[model samples]
Target chain A: MSRTRVQHFSISLDGFGTGEGLSRQAPFGHAGERLHAWMFATRFGKTMFGQQGGTSGVDDAILSTFAVGIGAEIMGSNKFGYPGWHENKDWTGWWGANPPFHTPVFVMTQHKRAPLELEGGTVFHFTDAPPADVLAMAREAAGGRDVRIGGGVRILRAFLKERLIDHMHLVQVPILLGRGVRLWDGLEGLEQVFDIETTASSSGVTHLMFARKGG
Target chain B: MSRTRVQHFSISLDGFGTGEGLSRQAPFGHAGERLHAWMFATRFGKTMFGQQGGTSGVDDAILSTFAVGIGAEIMGSNKFGYPGWHENKDWTGWWGANPPFHTPVFVMTQHKRAPLELEGGTVFHFTDAPPADVLAMAREAAGGRDVRIGGGVRILRAFLKERLIDHMHLVQVPILLGRGVRLWDGLEGLEQVFDIETTASSSGVTHLMFARKGG
Candidate 1:
């Protein structure tokens, strides 16, 4: 029974997951990592960048669960690379030679490509299939463990709309990204199916955890 | 030196202050009392209804400040009365003989009407003045005390767009209204002028407090 989960997803106060004007140079566009600055200040976020001395508070505790009991990851094309990265066959990913995901990573895109095996047991599986097909593939690849939805907002919203997500954690940063890719659009009355719990940290970000009811 | 403040204003997680289809029967429309239900569970809200025994924790402590240091109040027409309420001349307001507000209340509306004085010190004065003019009038009526911006979202958004609000405290309810009057629209980059603080109560509502810098 592998659960589908979305972890450590950050959004602005105005519900934007990533800012507008995204490019190769500015991955998050004008957002400039502000949405995830809180996580960066946490112990887990610091360890990701090979840094030290971060807070071990609520943020750190929750963010540390990113790698817990997970086997495979499914990410959107936007998160895999910038606009038109599929055209350039050389584009492996934003992550260097050895990516953090030490498992089979499925990139949901219309353009299919050969599975590129990277260091640290990470393999990129590009697929043109829909969510259910991708989920099934990811689940099989995950063995008996859970599958993570590594998103850039659009993919997360699509999964949420289809009721494919089991557990979701959204970190709400306290900044107004006036223009960006919104997360809450079209997913109205989401509380009907999920139980939402809100917790605020001293570092100024609010964690909204949503668990599917009776799942 | 009276400061313009907005206190205890509740909005849904999706940013809707009030739901659609407003009428005399359902003041908040589809939203009903869900947004203010947390406040009602507080000691201050219980005391308002002449009841006793309610939570006096963070929610109560913060809600108890709704009337602190306020002289006069300014609100939108939507908050004053339901749509087409002006057609019925006898209609005073949603609140009965003795309204909650005990200050000289200024109702911003296009329709001009004579002053309607209710029980206690609450007097309804209808005016079509803009945000600045209404603030000046409310300030004058407030004397040396602070003036509160009692909103239904539209008026508050107007005042916020004009940057006339000195302090604002918004309670974000967990429920998603889906559709209604939104609070955050057109007022982008608001954080540049106001410093925001967030606190979550045990009753499952997040309080967002914004104070203008150097005001």
Candidate 2:
């Protein structure tokens, strides 16, 4: 069975999961961008982004997991990298024309925007549905694969509140934005146990995979 | 004579920032929020956030610098942490009624919003202003008091590109989101020199600082 899993999420040492203000120009801001620098230069990203001469090695081995086992993806509107509801809504998002996730994507948004259709088998579904509704949707879309509880912050916490997560994968980079949009803002209670797997990248990013207790 | 100096910022050996999905619930998420766990409980942050009864000592000293000598502040719209532009033109940002910064705040944005007046001596100015313009604003506002270039990656990079930043404070946390956003996207061509200052918090986050060359 596919329990809930939060795959490949990074956190900052300042106890902030993400740097504040993820905007178009600086999605990750200051040290925020350094978190994923390793992945971009990796063979996986280069190949996906259609760049030539990408390096291959252990890093590539790690990069391989980025797309391997996974069913559907979930994220907040900001996580989708799109801001605001426009009249036309023609913006295909910041990923140029094609985005990496080519499957059904569940986007969390409060407003009412039509679902987005993309070239590479990607469809954006906007929902004001509850976390449970979204998760249920993701699981069905997964088709017995796995669910990626992708996100901004609030979306992820929605699932974590009920312990609906199964696995978490993150790449922690060596940088810090003292304070901005910190990962931990309102979580003062609730406890968790994480089985962690870690590795340091050549560019100095640390990759980790976490699994919740007992499936 | 500005030397490259890194300060106050912290990170982890594994590079996971506090945690992914910085929302009100899990806050730092799992081991993620643990990034800044050491600071909020310290003296400086307590004072800044206006709380009482925090532990003081080594951690307080460290926390102080994150706020100390901060003559001015720089941030992008994202760093502002307001819900969305749809809210209203007069948004004062996430810092409570009275914000932490008592100086001029330079906000970089595409849309020009009206300047926000805050409870304390804080005024928010929006400009499609280039990084140079923003820095000029910050420096002018700084009045020789040494400005703190605060932000997510894009704002920082824009400043870095112009070589206008004087000192950078970073905290490296050990939490990784394999893919979400990376900090160095536009870092390819920017020129920067690193002078490192290392400090460790109880939560295992590493603090770093940088002062650019030739301020």
Candidate 3:
């Protein structure tokens, strides 16, 4: 069965997935690379960025599961580019020529544009449909593989609120980004739906896995 | 020099120190015993509550610091009793005759009342003063010993915002309380003030210790 999964989604100690004032220059604003420093230090992150020499520990083990069975990805518009990416039609994404996502990437946006095919099997399809409908489209494109929910916090909360996520792996970084869009704002009593487990890594990030119960 | 410390403070993965709807019947509200379950299973908790035989590990080692070298405790009114405890003059506290705090405890409340001395060394002094003023009074009563900041969430956040805490130990339980008074609210850039360290315990709770830099 094809499952919807969120892997290696990092959040601050205060539950902020991304800090405020997200711009083209400062993608994560005041939070900078603090929330994602743990991942960048892992072997999986180093290999993903075409770099060499990184720690191969518990953090690397967890991050390595990110692209295993992922056949399609549904990312928030913010995850693709800055706030005003729509204004610049020529803008592709932060990922240069060949993006990491080798599958059909669905970008949830109000301004739908022509389908973009980048280098290395990566393709961007824009749509403004609701989560369920968009997810259905992504699932069909997954081709028997799992669909990944790429997040910037808001979109992840939306899918989570509707219980669309089957398995979620959230990394809780120790830094406190006192202000930002919080991921757990309306998710009160989330324990009722998902069986949660936590593991602390030596890199100062706690890995939390939430699997939907009876799904 | 007497230092202000916080220990054994349990919070949900969402950074909620206590859940909503706190009352005399449900102290932690919807959170129940889920947050403190990690501590209850520790050897220190078993001995503190007059029980026998509990696990002695990282959790027990952390929980053991609760009563050590602490002269006086300054806690929020919510920690002392349920909301509107001033209406019931006879209501002492939730801890019956002998409470765990064996020192002068100053309870911050708007409706100040006469001090209530319990069976044990716990004496509750009601004060409407701010954190700094109350800390002064507690320090004097502490008699050259360190003062502890007993919390219910709001008080702890207040002290943290003012940069009054010297040492803080927070246990991050796996559960998620979606709705509650958040502890990290308005405490933006807290990493700048303290050096934070994390340790994941076998009991599934991550211990986060924040020691004030150069303190």
Candidate 4:
């Protein structure tokens, strides 16, 4: 069975997945890169950024699972690029030419664009379909492997609210980003649906894994 | 030097200190005892309720610090009892005649009530003074010992907003109490003033320690 999973997602102590006032210049707005700082310190993150030498502890180990059985990814347009990215026709993505997602990357957007086949087998498929339909499409495209829910807070919250997520790994950073898009706003009584496990890393970040009950 | 500390404070993953619709019947509202379940499983919590034989790991170790070097406690009236607890004049507290505190416990309330000295040196003093004034009174009552900021969300937030808290220990429970009194509201950029450390316990609860800088 192909699981719909959310991996390596990060949120602040106050529950903000991304800070307020997101823009092209500030991808995470006032939050900046603070949420992903823990990931960047990991060996996986360092390798992803074409660097070397990072921690090989629990944080690194968890982040390294990004490609495990993941054949397709569904991400929100906001995550694919900055706001008003549709206006820029030349914008491929934040990645230069070869993106990290070596899978069928589904970008949920109202502005349809031709599928851009990038290097390393990463194909950006722009779609305006709803979560379930997109999931179906992604799952079919996945071809037996699992589907990954690439998020920018809004997308993940939608999937979670709809109970479409089968498994999730959230990194809870200690910093309190006072304002931003909250991931847990309407997610009340979440414990009833998911079996949760928490682990603290050496770098002072708590990793929470949520597995859907009986999924 | 005397420090104002908050110990054994529990909050939901969504940052709710206590659930909504609080009443006498439901002390923590819909959240019930879920937030403090981790603590209840600890030896400290079990012994506090006159029980025995519980886990004595990191969670227990942190909970056992409920009375370390504390001489006085300032808590909101909401924590003293439930909503409209003042209507019931004979109410001493929830903790029978023997209560837990072996020191002066100031109950912050608009209604004035005479001090009730219970068993085990626990005295409940009702005060309507502001946070600083109450802190001053509690500091004097502490007798050079560290003063504890006992919270029910509102009081702790007030002291925190005033930058009067010297240290705080927050247990982040995995459960999500959708609606309730939030703790992290308006407390943005708190990391700038305090150094935070995160540790995950065997009980699946993450312990967050915030030590005020230069305190």
Per-candidate TM-scores read 0.97, 0.51, 0.94, 0.97
CA lDDT, every prediction?
0.91, 0.62, 0.90, 0.92
Candidate 2 lDDT, A73-106, residue by residue in tens: 8888777663453343665566766777787788
Give lDDT tens digits, candidate 3, residues A49-91: 9899899999998888878999999999999999899999899
Give the DockQ (2 decimals) of all models: 0.70, 0.03, 0.72, 0.87
Q: Which ranges in model 3 have alpha carbons more than 4 Å from their true place?
A: none
In model 4, how large is the Cα lDDT of residue A13? 93
- DockQ of predicted candidate 4: 0.87
* Model 2 chain A weakest 10-residue run by lDDT: A183-192
DockQ of candidate 2 is 0.03
Q: What does candidate 4's lDDT look like per residue over A1-215, in tens digits?
A: 99999998999999999999989999999999999999899899999988999999999998999999999999999898999999999999998889999999999999999999999999999999999999999999999999999998999989999999999999998898999899998999889899999888879888899999998
Residues B77-168, candidate 2: write the lDDT tens digits. Answer: 76675326425654567677788777778788776777777887888878887777777777777776666666555566666666665676
Regarding DockQ, does 1 or 2 come out ahead? 1
Docking class for candidate 2: incorrect
Compute the lDDT for candidate 2. Answer: 0.62
**With candidate 3 superimposed using the best TM-score fit, by how many Å does residue B94's alpha carbon deviate from the native?**
1.5
Clashes of each: 0, 86, 1, 0
Q: How accurate locally is residue B132 in candidate 3, as Cα lDDT from 0 to 100?
A: 98
Docking quality of model 3: it rates as: medium
- Cα deviation of B89 in candidate 2 (Å)? 58
Task: List runs of model 1 lying over 4 Å from the truth.
Answer: none
